[model samples]
Target: MARRRNPFDIFSDFEEMFEEMLREFEKMGPGEHISGPFFYGFSINQRPGEEPEIREFGNIRPERGRIEIGERKPLVDVFDTDKTVQIVAEMPGIEKEDVELNVEGRELEIKASRGDRKYHEFVELPADVDIDTARASYKNGVLDITLNKVEKNKGRKRINVE
Candidate 1:
């Protein structure tokens, strides 16, 4: 007979794995210093008929008992609608003035910096958006953005043959 597993076991397993990794990271040689402001996190997406999607974002990477740090990639979610595209990002401890956004064609770039915390991410939009119709708001560590989709030309242009 097969044994059933508890759903809460997932968190315990993840905690144990994280602790083991931290222990391994601490085995570095003397004079090797690990700097602060390191961050690592992951998000899980579950759908009714699809496999779970796991995404990792952070500036710090744990490799061979060493850590490498860079610009943090903020966790983001994009929703495409018939008339618009919405983007939401989580960036805590940052003021609204510190954030910057740039849109080009079907791409969007987000960047922010505050003290020791910095974030940067480039997202490929699902459709072309009207740059002049963008609206953004930030409150309580969450940034919300909406842009109108550019309408496609339905009529084909005729070319004269030589």
Candidate 2:
């Protein structure tokens, strides 16, 4: 009778183990990777030079898919008139001094960061706007932003004469 090899011996070359897994998956079927249920996402945009967080391939619990992470949820409200576009965003725990607003052409950029929490979002205006004329005021845990939209070029009115 042949003696069973120790599992520790199989894991000696950890990196090479992934190749064996790939071969096994290929032999099963192309549908095997996505079909069996358990899945994890890999994001390349994580902080540079930081190793990704990996969880051991353990008991499969589909219920874990419901977990959500990241910064706190943000609330934004935008309204505009002929003269100006107004935006009010509610971001608690963020101070007015921490908020910075920038306008380039018709895009309004709001960046506010405090500690590990940050809120960054861009809003496109109805048309071009003057960045210099735009104003920002943050108070009462709400950011008030106003942008003076650029004046529309006057279109010639056509009239048919008989």
Candidate 3:
């Protein structure tokens, strides 16, 4: 003789599993927008013996009437010429008064918040610069920052290791 399984028992097991899955998804938080299994508009590249690198191209949620959860990091590019360092950043839908910039040592920090959008980013400069001499301008949702390089002798100190 063989043992028989009840169909109702099998259905009950499936229902429990589905409910568990839903509970886990709810933990991600209410009003959390996710387009798919992975964050939309992002790509990942994996190489042998190396960690995966993720790059985000844009936001997938509807641009209008979307509520963001936390601070977003804006895309920025830093470059240097012979005498100056330049930083260009894209911050859409932000006003001039909503943006704040700070430079300490070789690090540059940018923060902006307006309406329902927030952005923050930190950049390490290629060379030491005079923060007081930095000039910045924002127009049409873009920010351009320029800093003059400090003289090498004045920018570095020789520490006597005792």
* Candidate closest to the true structure, highest lDDT: 1
> lDDT tens string, model 3, 34-147?
552221233455668987555443332223333232466676777788899999988888999999999999999999988767777788899999988999999999999999
Q: lDDT order of candidates, best first?
A: 1, 3, 2
| Two-way TM-score contest, 2 vs 3, winner | 3
Candidate 3 regions off by >4 Å?
Answer: 1-69, 154-162
Once fitted onto the true fold, the runs of candidate 1 whose alpha carbons sit more than 4 angstroms away are 1-27, 47-51, 62-67, 154-162
- Candidate 1: give the clashing pairs: none
Query: TM-score for each prediction?
Result: 0.73, 0.51, 0.57
Which residue pairs show backbone clashes in model 3? none
> Candidate 1, overall lDDT?
0.83
Q: Which model is ahead, 1 or 2, in terms of TM-score?
A: 1
Name the runs in model 2 displaced over 4 angstroms: 1-68, 155-162
RMSD of 3: 12.5
Q: Report, for all candidates in order, the number of backbone clashes.
A: 0, 0, 0
Model 3 accuracy (lDDT, Cα): 0.72
